[model samples]
Target: MKKQIFGFKCAFKGIIRTINSESHMRFHIVAGIYVMLFSMFYSFSPTQYAVLVLLITSVMALETVNTCVEDLCGLVADRYEPLVKFAKDAAAGAVLTVALGAAVIACIFFLDFNVINTIFTFFAENLLYLIFLLISAVISAFFVVLGPVGIKEKFIKLKNRHLTKG
Candidate 1:
């Protein structure tokens, strides 16, 4: 049990490392969060939600594998080589392929005009909720683009600037 727990921890650590190093990973995570959130606004069957979950996780897994492959190839090769490039590109292509497929699936699942209008009306009627959602989205954008470490470094720099000013 202890070994299994440790293994899970290690897996989570790898995911965090991937999120920090890979912008695409962060983007996928952020997008997935929002997708799941909006998915709740629509009425989906249990099976539909299960499929969405599977597709989301599949993209995430492929992205993690791509990162691992790219890192391993870079570690193995000191200089540029055709094979190394081939490996990295193939890994990236895999992520892209799945991501595109996921998008298509999502569109098919949730592109109802009535549901979209209802979603729009939901925000329109609840201005406060809309404001909060927009705020969260802006923050999520920063998380996706700058990443956790980058955001922390920015905060540290901001504090230093304030100290210098004082």
Candidate 2:
């Protein structure tokens, strides 16, 4: 029983690592945050919430699998391997497939149910709030991309200076 528990724990850790390592995971996390805020502001039925959760999970899972495929291809392929290119393309295609499905579901839910209309009405009534949301999204995207690069470069430069001094 102890050994079985240990095996399950290791597998869980591996799954977490795969999800966390994928770049798309960041986007999924942002989407999840949006979902949470939306849910809090707009009362969704239990079924709607369940569907949203499943859709988000499916997209994130596809992204994680795509990352795994890319990692495997990199491990096996040389700089100019045709098979590696094929593998990477196939993995990306899978993610695209999931994304397309998610987009359809989102349209069905948001458009068919007039959620977008309601949001637009709210924004029209309160332009300041809409502007705040747009500004926040822009700032978040900017920091998400550039913040890590700045930190990495700073660390690299600090390490080089330390090495030279030593």
Candidate 3:
């Protein structure tokens, strides 16, 4: 029993580590901000919220899987390998699949008058919430872009420094 518990704990820790990694965490944070904004603007019916939640979760989950696949490929192949390329591409394709489906669902939900009317009503009645949503959207966009660009730039600089030293 103790051994089983320990094994479960280890697996849980590994899951947490993967989810908390920079790329996965950045996407999760952005998804969370979008969820909050959506909640502020509209009160989704139970079915609508369920669908929205599932869509968001699917996107984030696929993104995490994509990151894991890329990381595994990098670890296995020090340089480029055809199999690694295929694996990474397939993982990315999964994310794109989920994203496209979610986009369609979002259009269906948002284009309806019921959802739009609720959002407009909320905006008119709750000025503070609307302001908060705007501010959060701006900040979320900045962080989402900044995180990846900063990491990419840092890696490029490091590579250059190593080349100079060599």
Per-candidate TM-scores read 0.96, 0.66, 0.67
lDDT scores of the candidates, listed in order: 0.94, 0.74, 0.75
* Better structure of 1 and 3 per lDDT: 1
lDDT, candidate 2, 10-86, per-residue tens: 87776667644554666666676676565654567899889888888888777777888888888887687888899
On TM-score, the candidate that comes out on top is 1
Q: For residues 1-166, write the lDDT of model 3, one tens digit per residue.
A: 9999999998676656555564545666587557646665565688888888888877877777787788889989998789899999999899888888877887776666877788788878999988987887787665565565665687899999999999
lDDT of 1 by residue, 5-54 (tens): 99999999999999999889898998899899999888899999998999
Ranking by TM-score: 1, 3, 2
Q: What C-alpha lDDT, on a 0 to 100 scale, does residue 20 get in candidate 2? A: 47
- Return whichever of 2 and 3 wins on lDDT: 3
Candidate 3 residue pairs in backbone clash: none
Residue 40 CA displacement from its true place in model 2, Å: 4.7
Off by over 4 Å in 1: none
Query: lDDT of model 1 at residue 144?
Result: 86
